[model samples]
Target chain A: MTAAYYAAVDWGTTSFRLWIIAEDGTVLAERRSGEGMTTAAKTGFPAVLEAHLAAVAAPAHLPVIICGMAGAKQGWVEAGYLDTPAALSTIAAGAVAVPDVDRDIRILPGLAQRDLQHPDVMRGEETQLLGAAGNLGDGRHLVCMPGTHSKWVRLEGGKVTGFSTFMTGELFDVISKHSILSHSVADAQVFSGEHPAFLAAVAAACANPALATNLMFGVRAGQLLHGATATDAKATLSGTLIGLEIAGALAAAGAVDSVCLVASGSLGALYRAALASLDLSPRIVDADEAVRAGLSTAAQAIWPL
Target chain B: MTAAYYAAVDWGTTSFRLWIIAEDGTVLAERRSGEGMTTAAKTGFPAVLEAHLAAVAAPAHLPVIICGMAGAKQGWVEAGYLDTPAALSTIAAGAVAVPDVDRDIRILPGLAQRDLQHPDVMRGEETQLLGAAGNLGDGRHLVCMPGTHSKWVRLEGGKVTGFSTFMTGELFDVISKHSILSHSVADAQVFSGEHPAFLAAVAAACANPALATNLMFGVRAGQLLHGATATDAKATLSGTLIGLEIAGALAAAGAVDSVCLVASGSLGALYRAALASLDLSPRIVDADEAVRAGLSTAAQAIWPL
Candidate 1:
């Protein structure tokens, strides 16, 4: 069997994943845990990484390439950002090395849109973009990466012209748990993309994004006046947020020929359905694979086998 | 002072106000407390009302006219709703008397827009509308009542055409408290409508209401990348929500001659400033006075002396 070449880690705010890859680019071992940057920050980033590395039985000298919050200012090491307009290939050049470590460890820098008006910053998603860029090829593509903070990137050729982050997932969470709509969706049964309420909300919000909050309120009113089920309320809330996101993204990236959605699991499915509902079939890219591929690309660039 | 003739009360979701009126229709004594429907629901609504009434030194036989959440199905009595296109004068006639109560207490009905597409209900704000209608007269007036759940009413010839509720204030609260933006506005100083950040955000949101959530995210991004102040973050958040609400309200109302702002205190000042930023000078009305006037209007109609 080929020896492990390097370890790739996606250290997020609340999740940690590690992959031991062979020189042949095959994943030899894998590990995942909830001890992400948040936990690692408290329990020492090195210790947490070492524990995960040990769990994967990675070679002692196996170099590691890390992305996401581990590179944030509040993460393991402060890996600064690359200001846009930036080339996806240049991300490897901005990777920051951890000081005084036995094994070589590098954390990829984030992207910063320093436009005084917009002034957006992204940590982990840049890596995903780097990986997804291959699938997107050299064209003007609107890439939607759905997550806690859903990012919509405008990529021209291999360069990221601009991007916008919608607080979709986070807003959904806070709204459901903290807002008055909480009562409307309490103990809601699991719903899917095909939900009537969800589809209708997506259509309504995409049509009139101005009425996003009003539509959110309708979740409660619908339950009260229309006897809308808990699931209906939940679906409506989800669709409203997702729909507003799509509208804003479309508005920002005017007349895009293709949309690349880099997402995983249920979230990806949801976004795909929403996009389809809006008469757009986005090019699907598995986010998990994209991040791993991105980390591998960075690792190969830094330590070519 | 003349003996107390009737007690006018505005019982809301989180607040309660009582005004003892004399035979001359003058406020002889007044009481205000946080014993709103929420508190009353847990601690007996009748007891809470009696405590406030007794504090105001109202006569036992004095009739009481109440409005707002006290008339909700979950409140002291189910006063029900007056469906649209409802005449402002019809609100008093639909008042539901508190069954088996010592006093002749009647809680005024709220307004319900039962359109299946946009089902909406308002309690206390309906009373405010009832009073504000007298001042507005026969016209196409867009009434913007800014609060936790801001109600934008469309009145055509003293009859309610329709209305929309923007969850502006509640969203601000939940987003500021529970979302990542919480860090951006942790110790924010009190800011008003004149704030440059506030004005800019208001302008941005109004112009591009579709980008409401994105604008909301900018509060955090601005802080992280542009070193935006806490006050700036807070003001920006305030402006974004209010501006989006205004945009939605205007879009829903369509071609109104004038905008009527019925609000109180700093919130009123804030809305006025937000409206002015968009070149809209809304005719202002005190929310407190409007509710009182609405209750008085209902009182006179229910039990004409």
Candidate 2:
């Protein structure tokens, strides 16, 4: 029998990625293209799918599961939102059925937080959460997904009870890239946490959260007065923002007791150290692995034996 | 005898503006061009000066005064800062004498706050303060200069002792241009202070300063949930930011008691009403007039008859 192939799509704002999977949930062929929601505006949805499929010679009909910006309001088709506290099993279990596909195509609904004093929302992270629960297996877990908008989510028995977002990455991008601090930072400065300069910035931000406004100028002061390198200054700025986010998140989520970070790449490792500074044990997991695992969970639901 | 023509140069990051003045400081001709610090990267001091002369026909032997980004470290020339409690007259009196100019050419030194726990800096706004002092003739005036980085300076007897910089304009630009709030706001919104909508937003920001962060999302929430028009939502966001800036500046400077604002233009007038909500009086003035008056103060100091 021909191996049943499944498709997983992580459609984001600036890029759309696709992974073709075999029956055993291994990625058969992966493809990435520039057809994100923003760029696919004039051409619209049909063009996005057609551009990605142009590379692969596959059967016309196949089961496909997708997540992320494709589910946003202005996306190809809005998948709406799954109100929290949402169960990982429930999230994996629920899918927005697509219209007019020769084969079954389901779009995942993102998690939404309302009815709280302050409402918050998330779209793609739900898939990551479901995948985390599947990988770690049905128990209480804390996941810190850091990006432009970092999400701190709590899962108990594979259900997402609550989550909060910190604009740390976006804030850093804005302040360091656009604000007065930009003058202090050089174009190319990427430092690791082991650096003494990085440690100094984390310590300062940790000591006084409000000092962020003033501490930003320290980059310039360091450069002008002490002749500190631009690379060190950039690292310091990043460390300061991450440290502040971690402190604020810990207080808000009460995650200091039991927190595990689900991040990827250098940003993930940086966050791991940031959490460690505040005496929190963090289990850093590969984000891509979780994305694949999530696709498997959805595939299993759709192709149950 | 022909009227002794004075020259005012407002050199900034991305643009250069100059006003040729008659003996009484009346503008004869004003010229604007994109020879700001950012554009004149390859060509240093001489290029910036030459760029100005190219845009505006000024006698090589004319008394000329300059300010703004040209004094920055990266500018054509770095004219050092004048420490506070600094009077405009003091900086005018101590104008940096640029060599090689046959006529009197003095670069005004920007003001800096010293007595405060942390120091603050101002370049172009010092000119605005001087203009306010020269025009209003001093006596406890509160001046608000709105721009990318807005400054609130408290002047008593033509002396700018202390001031605070609020990233109000920058924050608005960031949130509207980059943040999630951008979706809810329209391209432009008309200001009508008497409208219940406007007053409600001002009150919300004033009632709880910490709510400033929360208020930002209200623009989106108001549009999405409350059936608010995009224009109204945008206006509310703008009002809230400006209102927060006013409240924070007032509290920080301890100028709540008997404070009178010197604002410029209709946008300035709208802010005046926002200030009035807090039981403070604000007078609207012309922005161009303030710059001219400021230039005149600097000119008189360098070329005292």
Candidate 3:
């Protein structure tokens, strides 16, 4: 059996994921839980990390590299941000050590854009960007990382020049559950990116991005007038938001040498489709693999694997 | 005492307002209550109407002209929508009378844009438009009626050509209370249009309407980084949403001969500031007076003195 070199943990706002990695960059074991920063803050971050490591049979000597909300001000430690125009390589060097712990544990710092006009921040995504675009001998790259707060980063010459955070995912959630559109999409079933309503909405929003909220109103109005199904309303809502994100991202980034989408699951498919609908096909990278790779890179740098 | 000609009631989703008028168009008495359509639907609508009438000592022969949610499918009578491009005069002709009532009570119908691409409906705003812009001769007019669901209507030659609804107010309420930004704006104080943060946000969103959601995220990021006060965050939010609404409204409206604002109170002031920021000085009309004028016009049309 391969000996574990180190452990990697991606701690988010409401989720926890850990991987026991071998010396040869193999995942020996993995664990996922809902005990993220919010849960760990209450139940003890050290205790939670230890329990997960023990369950995975990770050795005491196995150094752990952490990333994400675990380093937030409200998290385990204040792993402060590295201001923007920041090189991707510095992300690994900026790993913050978890104090007074026996194990060699470190949490990576996030990225912050301090522009008063466009203030923005990202926690786990900076590391993800490092792993996803670290090796690229780039001119310029537009990296889209979708989540509760979808981030669009402008990477020029392997450095994050600036970035914008769109409240797309969060808005989708609140509008669906709390707004008047809730009634329209109350009975929505699982839908894919290829849904006609979704595609149509994407096209509409992309064509006229300024009519975003008006387009959103159409979701509910369509249901009332045309007897549109719940799925149609839900899909339209999803398409319109994703479409707006893409429009904003492109308009903000201007021209890019290449575009990369680092996302997974249903959201990845939707974004992929949204991009494709606009006649742009970005290089897709799996989000999980990117985060794990990021941790591995930072871990190797910190502990000299 | 002058004989009461008719009572004009603007029955909204959660608000009720009744104005007693004499045949000579003189104000007799006015009543405002919380018994809007929602409450009147539960308690008998006729009873609610009667109680208000009795409070003002209105005679049994005093007829009633109702507008807004009272005419909705869920209200007293199902006053169906008149499909656009409908003439403003048609609204009064579209009035549906309440059945099984001794009093001569009629509810004004709303306007519906049945266009597949942009489905929209306006309940009380149609009457407000009629009251505000009913006599505009042979020229196009853009009327903005700001409320919970703000409506921007395009009136051409006294006809309801088309209109768009921006979920600005609803989105603001939901986002402030439900999204992650809630933490940033928890202790927000009441801010007006004159606030610097509000004006700056309006300018930002107007400059790049696509960056709307990004600007929204900036509210939280600004709080996290700059220690922005809750009021600043709240004002920024308000400005961003209103700016997006204005941008979308203008983009969709193409161009018009004149712009009119039919609104009241603080919302009106904020919109006025937003429009002024974009160098637009719309003809301002009080919403209450406009609605009353609309009802008066429709009432005279229905039951001539």
Predicted candidate 1 versus true structure: per-residue lDDT over A1-305, tens digit per residue: 99899999999999999999999999899999999888889999999999989887888999999999998889989999999899999999999999989899999999999888887889999999999989887779999999999999999989999999999999999999999888889989988899899999999999999899999998888888889999999999999999999999999889776899999998888898999998899999999999999998999999986
Give stretches of model 1 more than 4 Å off: none
DockQ (Cα-based) for each candidate: 0.85, 0.13, 0.83
Q: Estimate each model's TM-score.
A: 0.99, 0.76, 0.98
Worst 10 residues of 3 chain A by lDDT: A130-139
The alpha-carbon deviation from the true structure for residue A279 of candidate 2, after best TM-score superposition, in angstroms, is 4.6
Docking class of 3: high
> lDDT (0-100) at residue B281 of candidate 1?
91
Model 3 TM-score relative to the real fold: 0.98
Superior by TM-score: candidate 1 or candidate 3:
1
Model 1 clash pairs?
none
Candidate 3: where is the Cα deviation over 4 Å? B134-137
Error of 3 at A154 (Å): 1.1
TM-score of chain B of 3: 0.98
lDDT of 3: 0.91
For every model in order, the fraction of real contacts preserved is 0.75, 0.02, 0.75
- Per-candidate Cα RMSD to the true structure, in Å, reads 0.9, 5.4, 1.2
